[model samples]
Target: VGSASIRPPATAGRRVPQGNSCNFGQGSRACVRLRGHALFRMAVRNAAPAVLGNALTCHVVAGCDVAAHAASGDTAGGQARGQAWKGLILRGWLRGGLPCGGQRCGSMRAGSCQGSRADVPMHGLLNARGQRRRVLVPPPLLLPLLLLTLLLPTAPPRCAAATSPTTRPEPSPQQAAAARGCSAEALLPLYARIDDDLRHWAAHGISEQLMDKALATQTTASGEKAIGVLFESGVPYVVSPLEEIDRLGHHTGLITAHLRFFEALRETFGPSIPDVEFIVGTADQPAIRLDRLENGALPYPLLRFCKSETHADVLVPDIHFQMRAFNATLLQQLDVINSVAWGEKAEELFGRFSQYKRIIHEHIPTLEVHGAGGENICHHANFELLFCDVREHFMKWAHGVRSSGAPVDVARQPRIKMIDHARYKYLLHLDGQTCSSRLEQLLVMNSVVFKEESGYHAFYHHLLKPGEHYVPVWKEGPEDVLEALKWARAHDDEARAMARRAQRFTQNYLHPDALACYWFTLLGRLAQLQRFEPGRGRRAYPVVLMASEYLGSNAGKAYVQKHGLSRMELPRAKRVEQRRA
Candidate 1:
């Protein structure tokens, strides 16, 4: 085998770090050496070179044949598993050479030998013509995380213990408001669109007619799954997206997070947030005012928030995505609850899945093979023939591995375990693709964030102070991260102190009560922009139930029942009047 393999690969001569192990091969013979413990057994069949794109090269592994691995015996699920593994291998999911010796011939250090294909290409990802090709791998594949998590019979106990009921009592709005500063001044910029919409709608005067016009426009804006939620007396109905979620969904968990966000606002602020029908979409987009396309005046209100799982930070904080990182990997198995706060629980989870704990128990005996090095896929990094961006990043800085390999991009990028992020002294937060969701999650990880400067920001960006909450990094080029890395290594204490400050800011200001208060204040401002009364709309759920259609199951009903919020009294919107800004 040559250079094509998983990113952050088990390099040749790199001993399987003892402690935890990953069984990655399919064979009766063991090629594993984790402090000399027999861990993974894989029998690779040698076949023809796998074809990548026209220019990218693929070399044949000595004994690694996709056809044989897919066709037969010990590697179960015959055709299905075979095709799956074959797809993984061919797509460059697992490639590279192994560290041959020891387990195969009782010699601790043996040279590379042929396990299968006699014509194994030891040089590079070269072709028949010997032309070198450069191929940048896609982000990491998600199948490995899914495959590994399924191996756990049940998740370790959630931050909340089910029996004793780790759920905490809800803090009163008055109590929370009294303890925290309730200034809406810092947050007004977060809703600049609301002001723009209001100025536009004021000229039109009729909210009813304005909505009728807006709804017609929305209908044609990609007729996918868009449900509008008319908030009558603080009770939420359902909403719309632009031409994303792809336009119906982006991930069901995010939709639930936003719906529940409205529910939490209703819970904390009562009906003071006026009756308004909002086409609240959960996407990495800006608030939509259809009129922006027309006269730039106030039209029907709509907001498309990035809606990270942590946006639960804007409201409940209990329906957290980070607790189990449920949204990223682990499927829809969100049957998790944190008895403690997510920030605190994160520390525990990090240590629990610590890359240090994977102890692989091997059950197969090694078969003595002739002439083959029987390397354990680690030796494949030698050929500097092809270029890899991540490999280059690693070679240059020699620190800062990608922290969220499991849930985020796992392929082209090298990754560490989900919680291993805490173990990293410094974490780089780049606004990937758009304003990244990584910033929110990283600040809470107790590591210094090398936050790259970006124009995009969330509603809560006002709270972060550069040099206080994070160490700023210039995002001008690829080496921006490299620059930040050198600075942190030079000034260690200052970076650590900033991380402490960020942790304090998150824990003190990001409480469920404080976040709801932020939403509560934002809603009042949101309604001020509405020119017409928002009372006329279809009812979805009573303000008292708190159960949304998005809740999806009886477990939500039970959660509502247990929390004492289900039947909490609601302040009628018809009564309270808000002052015009």
Candidate 2:
């Protein structure tokens, strides 16, 4: 028998009737709950595994910067596509909940599970029904659709608009010469970070033995274990099915983003695009241990999405694939008021860093904060008081949790556009699952980023200086962030200058055109390092596949179909240009 609370989501036109409403807090709009039915939830998860992974992430399709939430039906299948995505995420939450308060997992009932309210972690809220039946769930985490909302699309840096930060010490002639200039060609913009990743992989060039092992480990799908793709004459022949980001993958797994990156590469290089077979690493965590390459457990190079410099994985343009260029106004009219922050409130990560919220909350009068998602804090340690509710703490999450219902939610902080972030004097950058994917966007904005220490780094992060680009927030504890906040408040000009300097750097180096160019340079460098002939090995297909056939998810299908990318056409060939080694 269905529980009294188990009910359907609100219809488009009707109000959520009475008790069915997900009452978050006073004055807050209710959170939409999933249809409380086990069979239906199971069916939804099975029907679209691809959409399931990204639904909890909202518009975070690698670089998807929603133009006013894409209300128009034109982008990637309109409203229907979005609703399907919502269902997938809601189901995922129901099926994949991790009970953090007590080790006892409880099934969903009355729009909640049998767990302590405080134990809800950061992702969800659980009710304390001590006598309720406890049934174990899988993986144990309700991945609220967002934290670093949409891997932010960064625009081509505008050199004309940049002013050297006034606080920066004068640069010597040598330093000036080394600085990236706007005149730098977009296709071959070189940075030491990109160079470092390539150089590391090139050193371990796929030996004949290594190639054989890599091929053997390959699964049939685009990213089950690994994927195989061959680019020839600027046209790509996907040798395996592609997977969108699912339970296991991050931004790199977005098939649409991957396709866009390849399409851009093809447009730039044409027939000159190198004929290389590669495995794109889609996970936030690097797959191949660079240190353990000798073990041969995993044999080849992985072009990774995350900055894998420390882990020995090859780095590539990550969010750049999904995102367009950042196009917000060059510099904002600064308010220089309270700082804002958004974080991925997963219980394990958030609870570990909950003190950050506690500190920010304690200092609420001076600090106004907002962001999305949360994880329950307690882990069998307490029956209550986990991640029950912290919305009173402003600007705290990355992306808000998505459910099946209308767009409006009064209970939480409203969405803050990346461009609007410039209005504040400061923005806090925190690590979610890895490095914050939106870091590039935050740096491009005029506001100073109080960046916390994180394990992951993007390839471009190497170009940043802690003092020059952003003020550092120590990971030692939450007290450090408090001190950093005080420092920013005390020395305002330096903060502004630091923001200016960081913006200038992006304008010079992170331009969108520079990105397409960077790919060209990166691929050319990889071509130079490739010792073997492309078609000479057993890996070459007798008849290459149309890249569109590789779409393996509903989202991928919608993306390719929405755009006219389903055609089987080769790019016009171009003369191979000589690249600087």
lDDT of all predictions, in order shown? Answer: 0.38, 0.42
Best by TM-score: 2
lDDT of 2 by residue, 106-177 (tens): 111112111121221121112222122222232223323221112333231112112211212333322322
Model 2's alpha-carbon lDDT is 0.42
- Tell me how candidate 1 scores on lDDT: 0.38
RMSD score of candidate 2 (Å)? 26.8
Number of backbone clashes in candidate 1: 32
Superposition error at 540 for model 2 (Å): 3.9
